[model samples]
Target: MYKNILAAVDGSSHGDAVVEAVASLAKLTGATVQVIHVRPSQVIGGAIASTVVPVEEREESQRVVDAAVARLRGDGVTADGEVDEGLREELAAILIERSEALGSDLIAVGPGHYSGISGLLHPSVSRGVAKISHVSVLLVRSES
Candidate 1:
């Protein structure tokens, strides 16, 4: 029944699988896919001194999105793409807002890198989004 899907991706090698899953789901439901990648913030803590993103980081982010789009197209699905700053950039809020702005029926997120203790101590954006989203969210675990 989903007509619009917010596919949240990290652009990791594992995350690519989530894109494929989203594409198949979109095909089945006749939904439009809104692909999003959050780059996290350029700074951490109160100061911007910790910024790690070089000027080329933006290009890298763009490349990630482009590659994802190409992958989807190869699968015969053309999805819209948007790249935002990640963790430091408040990816959680962006994901929530974009899903709403895009009128997405569901938000699909890839499983994160964290596992075991890390996953337990610091829930990822995906976990956070799943807890907070008003709409339904589908998680494609990394292994799957």
Candidate 2:
């Protein structure tokens, strides 16, 4: 049974699915939910590009978290949210850190891209989160 749940949202294609899944779980277990969206770090360009994310982008990340929290609340779940950013760490690391900070019992993640050459370039979110997190992780696969 989960007490506090941390749902990671990125406004991706599976964003809604993730919220819906987490809401169901939270409702069933009578647990509260905290949604978070990590602002993507700056991508280094050719040789040595700036590693800082734009201010607007960071604000947008917070908006994403707010929206997810709103959706969860609309589903009659007690939910709040926060925005996180990483200077050098990936999203998975950020999510795990936030979960620990919030004392979340479960970290819920949506489906990850696992096909084609692009998938090979980055590690899947679920795997990365599970590998680094101390608590349980729920990977809600996208409804095909």
lDDT comparing candidate 1 with the true structure: 0.76
lDDT of each: 0.76, 0.82
Please write out the lDDT profile of model 1 over residues 12-36, one tens digit for every residue: 7557877888889888877878888
**Number of the predicted model whose lDDT against the real structure is largest:** 2
Q: Residues 1-144, candidate 2, lDDT per residue (tens digit)?
A: 998999988787577778989999989999999998776664555666545654347668877888899889999999998877764347788888889989999999986765899587656777889998999998877766
TM per candidate: 0.81, 0.85
Residue 66's lDDT in candidate 1: 79
Top candidate when judged by TM-score against the true structure: 2
lDDT of 2 at 117: 92
Candidate 2 structure, TM-score to reference:
0.85
